[model samples]
Target chain A: MDFTGIVVVAGNYGSGKTETAINLAAACRKTGMAVNIADLDLVNPYFRTREARIPLEALGIKVILPDRQYHFADLPILSPAVADILRQQSDLTILDAGGDDVGVTVLAALASVLKDKSVRMLQVINVFRPFTNDVAGCIKIQQEIEASAKLHITGLVSNANLLDETTPEHIYRGYDLVQKVAAQTGLPVEFITAGQKVLPLLDMHRFSCPVLPIDRKLLPPWKRI
Target chain B: MAKVLMKGNEAIGEAAIRAGCKNYFAYPITPQSEVAEYLVKRLPEEGGVFLQGESEVAVGYMIFGAAGAGERVMTTSSSPGISLMSEALSYIAAAQCPAVFVNIVRGGPGLGGILPSQGDYFQATKGGGHGDYHLLVMAPDGVQEAVEMTMLAFTLAEKYRGPVMIMGDGLIGQMMEPVEFPDDLKTEPTNKDDWATNGMDTRKSKKRNLVKSLFLDPAALNDNNLALKAKYEQMKKEEVRFELYNSDTDYQVLITSYGTMSRVCRTAIDMLKEEGIEVAMLRPKTLFPFPEKAVFDAAAKDSCKAVISIEMSMGQMVEDVERCVKGQRPVEFYGECGGDIPSPEKIIDIIKGLL
Candidate 1:
């Protein structure tokens, strides 16, 4: 569960990147690793890592963002603290890179800094999303994120979910899609994520990688994991 | 078709295409911008037209132009963008053209935060634009309902020959859920040859079709208003759709809600049922007709003590709920806004306080 340096997560819009990033950070934190997560989802106005900041910070994990004034403004203002996180380097610095190439463009500015650091850029693939519904589509998203982020994706996270209605079938198919993408792209499948309810019913043998239990944090007030 | 996991915004875009609507013109705005993004690629692939207008104002006119020309047209926008299109909506309604407008409303009044809020209830239910007009508004509670409503909006727009709006909160535009596109809901565009100025030669007719909202003379304007009122009356009589939850037996508090807020109230009602407390909910699918009789009957139940309006705004829908209950029971209002959706627990607490 422990990772060195930074783990940047990026994918298409609505691909569960924020949830994956937050869960990944929490998993690392549970393993007694120092975790710092940066909220870089400027393209999305709702369901950002900042919404989970209170809980994440309460868990002793640092949540990085721009100044307090620009907290909820939905501006593409990447804070200097993001660079400092890359340089400061926690045991696991999970940079929740935004959705699509448009959102990942902010990470391009940190290309120079990423070169000197131990960076593991991970692409989250949700076969349920329109653009990334297949291997080709997933690969296209990976390429777009890499091109805009100016970094190569070293791993993939299978985050197939249908919010509240997710099932074990979705997780299995998601893993199958991620495996296909990994086989096509020659990248490692880092982990597969599922909501806590689905995790118990999933056939663990179906997945070759670690399983991350997603505790939804960026949900509306009425929703819960 | 098998159900697929889809975001509300993207599902709405696909619903429009499946419903035989090919023309989509929109400007990018938060929450609802995904609809434009999805259609920008998929529309052309279906041999349809997709245009990004310079602004919401221009986008609104594009819809009016296409709709007036007898084409099935749609545009999706957030609160501020919808406000910009309000003038064109009035024009389209006045001209008696069928146009579907989806307002994935964000927190509002003035460039409010981009989060779920039912603040646009008043704007959508009442005419956002000026001059006596009402856009047949439908408020969907979930992503699946959002898709269904988006598809139904097209047909309702054509049938009424006016603007139809699917008013949803930012959450409806952002959330993900499993949805199925019912093949039965796919409709062929109605024949608009009689009233459309789609070129008389195309319809093989000699009479010229005139489409305009301006009547110049006071008497003519009054007549047009009367005609519009007649159509609205027909809609109210035939298209008042609503769902009653937990009202079969008996309930002390009757909750009047719609869209995302209704879903929350439903969760609260179920949780309270576990605690031996009875609470019923009436969710309005069509906001225009308001389901007045349903609300009235539900409130008139002997077990019903008070009617409460639960919403994500500062009590916008309470006005309609109050009008519907007609003082049969004491009407109460509880709401939160600026992206704050009251939780099931908060609603439970509020309902318990009433008991």
Candidate 2:
């Protein structure tokens, strides 16, 4: 369960990468380690790590985001503080990347800084999404992300969810696909994510990695109902 | 005709390709962004043209230019983007250009939240843009229907040589369902050489053709308006489409709706029927023609005491229902806006009060 150094979370749109990154930051902080999150997702302004800034900051985790004036702007404005954090090499620095390779292209700017550092880039997979529904599809996305970000995916995180209707079977079904993907790609299943409600129902023995219980954040204003 | 699970937005993109529409111009907007995203990759593979315009306004004119050149073209956007394209839509209608515009409507007055809403009914059916013109608007209730109507939209647009709109809410765009775009529904693009702005030198005939909407002379303008009116009347007679449910059995109330709202009404009907309260539904597949006769005939049922218009808007379609009912039966309105969908239980409660 030791998550030290820089950890990056990457996935396709609606792949639950933001939630996974947020929960991963909280998990690292729970171990009494310094945590910092950079909202590197310039591709999607709607759902990004920046939306959970208040709570993460309250937990004593530093959150790096664009200037206040450009908070909602669609343009990519990577604050210099992100590079400073990468240089500082915090205990756990989680970079919540944007949806696809288009979003991950921003990460290439910091490739030189991250080259010598111990970096763990985990590709988050949500089986329910259109493009990443199969093993080959997941591999294609992995290759694309690696090509765009100029970084290698160290492991896989199974995050199969169906929003509000997600069930245990859905999680299990996604885990099966991720396992097949891991077998083909020779990557480890880092962990799986489930909603707090389904966490109690999941069989812990069925998974090889620890499970991360999600706290729903970054929901649309209308979906608050 | 292989069946596959597809979101409504992606299905519309696939349907346009199957309908021989290789030219697409659109700006990305919520709910309908997938259409442009899907086409960006698929169109280039099919040797078609796909361009993401700088804005919806620019995209509308791009479609106009392509359609004027006799190419099958389409564009997809949400409510606010459609509002930006209203001016071009009016000109497209006036010049009688054949193009399809898909509006996967979200809640709107300005830039509203990205959730399902049928608030664009008045805008689509009554013509949001200026001038005296109408775009043949088709409302599809589900993913499968959205695919079918998208394929049909090109045909209808070319048939009358005017703009056609496929209207659906965000629910239709985001939801996934198994669909098949039948090969039989594929249609050949209509010949546009007669009035199309294709270069005169390209054809054997050296007569130049202009596709402008302007009519400087009062007499010529009047004749143009009359011609457009005559075509609309012809459409009213030949193209009104609707679906009737439980019309055969005597019912206490008749619910009139379209698109996703009609599907909710169907569920409410089943729930009410379990309680022994009979209800009927008249779902309009075409919103412009409005299916006035079907609403009037459904309301004419002696046992049907009251008619209700259920929608996801602030009673826009209710006005049309009232117009059709003509005071023969009391008309009521129940709606939810800003992306709040009406539940079947809540609808059943409304039905109970009417009963």
Candidate 3:
């Protein structure tokens, strides 16, 4: 799994895109790549990539969030540092976009900066979600996201999960749905994400793409230490 | 009526649509926001109305106004959002409008954490707003139960001509479970020609109908209060609902719980039974017009040694439990607040201590 250049993770809400983005940044850092993750998610204030900033930074992954005072603000206060990162490409730069077309519209502001670079926008698909349950629904979301973000999705990431109750079947079912989506949208299945516990239980050969094992960094306030 | 896996929040939205509720007005709050999101697209496809109000306070009045005009309307919110809607809820209750409110409650006194909590017990059962009115509050334990309760909420709201509330915790809202909406539960909106403030020309008699909560005269206000009290009393007799688990045989301890906490108690009861500890659970499906008699009867069992109330709050429902026991036995309370769910092992420890 070579995560080079700028990778944007976008998906519908609760599709586990933030978790995938966090883990992808961590994965790139483990390979000695200089990774930086910009929290471009202004849609959801609760479960954004910035919530796991401390540990992500501990992995030597630089996290660029909104201005310090506006960390928890719902406003899309993009830091100038994100533009600097996009201008000077690092080993791996990840832009974790917010959920849905409304969230991805923030990317249109940086579209020109991202236009010249080799950008990979991965649409994280969770078939269990209400809107993206079927292939047509997934395609419709993909088209809307591309139109709003002013960039086409390069690949798909199957992130089918049901929180604590997620099983191997959920992952496989998501993989199958994304495969169909990939066929329809002409995008490759970049990878499938699962929690560290469920990864070993999954048959890796069944999926065409590699499996990215996720570390649970995003937790509710009560679950945090 | 095929079974499909769905989050509790989305399931409740579908259930509302199935129950003939075409109008939905709500502000997005954590846990319950999915209900509004799901309906925003679905209701439009179903030729229904969906609107995200500027705030929960505004959404509550939106529901009241819509319901007053003879539409089956509803709103969904969390704890703090529901607090904002309490004022409109009181107005709706006073106006005798049929509307439904779903509170996928999170922990809160004010701006509390967005996690599962049954802390809104008093707000839903007792009046949260400044009034002496009660909403028909139903608590469902799982996704399927949440759907069923939401459907029932519409009917009960119309039958009693008042607001009905379906209370669920964040766990019930976020969790995924296979649910099938029963086709038999499909319903038509209750006819409101006589009382509803629809256009006067639409009425057969061509008479004007006004829906307002304000009563200028003291006697009229008093009469309205008396009528509401009578309706509440009638609900107490006819609408009290509960379920008894493992109560067929004699038990050493009786546990009282509701909603998601009740499901946790069931798991605890199964664990305790394996260790030769006999326990019975009495779960009230309706919080308002609470199944007080059922709780009293369960606690008064000959073999029951103690009664304990388990909740996802700081002993809110325990007050009701104690009232039911009435010193017949030792009553205890165990709870966890601020989004921390009580584990089955912890519950068993509490039960053993009581024994």
Candidate 4:
């Protein structure tokens, strides 16, 4: 009942950011609040918001993205129209920005519009992935992304695991590492996404910010729920 | 009841509230992001929901889920974001899930520059997503229309149990204008337990409702497509909106336009009229299920030598005008892309050249 504003899911490649984004939007919508997901992942072509457009649309949630262009790969095709939609005073607007420092450029253009808006830009870290395994490495990546996006990283989303074989212990270890990064960066640890099954195993009170139980759908057909 | 000055995007947020909408979800893009920002604080105070989705894809599904619950929900985005939402839009159309969507369009081909453009005409009017479905698309010309159409979008969407789109461009979203909130904005709250999944208790024990677009069998999908086409045909009878200016007079030329481009076209038409030239203008309020009859009547006689389609794109809307004319008169096009708005004087010169 304490619905506030949008929840942004962002991180480096292979961090399962998009999957987290989709699940978070779904969970909130299931609670009877209107939700929208934006596809700002202009880096990789595969597994984007456009792919989920039909299912989301059937549910009546608004999805925003760039039109597919075969001829050009790197045009500043980010539409200002998305900004227009964000200005609406009624709906909650979430921005699924692109991955990594380069992908976060989408937020730079929105500096003026997001000026006074209560926005939270969280950096998602995957400990299993290289270069972000340690607390210092995650903080560095977060700082670089913040600089590139011209926005502050508001919080942390610890989602460290090996796909399909993650354990509750893995979630706890990932949480500890992210807590260090959050302290080093002076950003709060917003949320940690544990597989729905793993949620019951982890102590619910250890972390600050909400703990979101996520259902994975981005993996191959055999791994998806 | 009071008139307030607001940008088009902000107006959409206010208008959605006026229409009794309690939930809104979207992701931030340009031009329309202000709408999301505005609603973040306002919706909570009004006892509503405001959330910024993770991505356009997730934002769209959020809308889908909320509308299935029978809450008056809405979302806003730009051309590219709308492109992302098109798949969801197609499903909403087929499943007859009523909701409102506002697109503040900008230029695009890949990530086309973030300027105003009408390039999405084909996508908006002729179906952007896969599947044989047509959404009821309304194009607002000014801030007032943007607000009014958003309010009306909710009503029409619920009336048909399908998605409604308010398609405008950055010009409308950024412009400031005066507006009057209608005193009588809400009607009796109709229960949609028949299809909406608000709660099981809302309906008597019967069968569970599933709002889905999946039909493994080709025959079932074909039937659904045919049924959608039939509904579109019926909508043609019920939903053709337009505004005619100087059409009553003996016009020498016809101007066709919509949204912000149409407003510029109006300026040129007025200039030409001041010079004792008899020229008229027709603005399409409903971009989809376009006002074909109005177009035909405006270009009725051979007395009108030519028709001109003015827009923000290079010439997207011109294609529709050409179809409407069908060799009845010469049709021409003029536009400025990448947010470059064509001045009225430039449009006037183009009109003079056409004459």
Which candidate has the top score in lDDT?
1
lDDT of 4 by residue, A104-157 (tens): 887878778778788777788877654577887787778788888888878788
TM-score of chain A considered alone, across all candidate predictions:
0.96, 0.97, 0.96, 0.87
Candidate with maximal DockQ: 1
Q: Is candidate 1 or candidate 2 better by lDDT?
A: 1
lDDT of 1 at A187: 93
Model 2 regions lying over 4 Å from their true place: A1-10, A14-98, A102-137, A147-184, A188-225, B184-187
lDDT of each residue in A46-70, candidate 2, tens digit only: 5568779999998889999998877
Second chain TM-score for model 2: 0.98
TM-score of chain A of 1: 0.96
Q: What TM-score quantifies how close candidate 1 is to the native fold? A: 0.96
**Better candidate by TM-score, 1 or 4:** 1
Residue A166 error, candidate 2, Å? 14
By DockQ, is 1 or 4 better? 1
Order the candidates by TM-score, highest first.
Answer: 1, 3, 2, 4
**At residue A82, what lDDT does model 4 achieve?**
74
**Candidate 4 TM-score to native:** 0.62
RMSD of 4: 20.0
lDDT of candidate 3 over B183-224, digit per residue (tens)? 645565556887899887776667788899999999999999
Per-residue CA lDDT of candidate 1, range B184-273, in tens?
A: 455555679989989988999999999998899999999999989999999999999999999986799999998888888988888899
Q: Per-candidate TM vs. native?
A: 0.96, 0.75, 0.81, 0.62
Instruction: Write one digit per residue (lDDT tens) for candidate 4, span B124-216.
Output: 878898778888999999878998899999998888788898998877886555566665467634748777876776676476777778888
Residues A112-214, candidate 3: write the lDDT tens digits.
Answer: 7888899999999887777888899898898899999999999999988765567899889999999999888788899989987788898888988999998
Q: Which ten residues in a row have the lowest lDDT in candidate 3 chain A?
A: A216-225
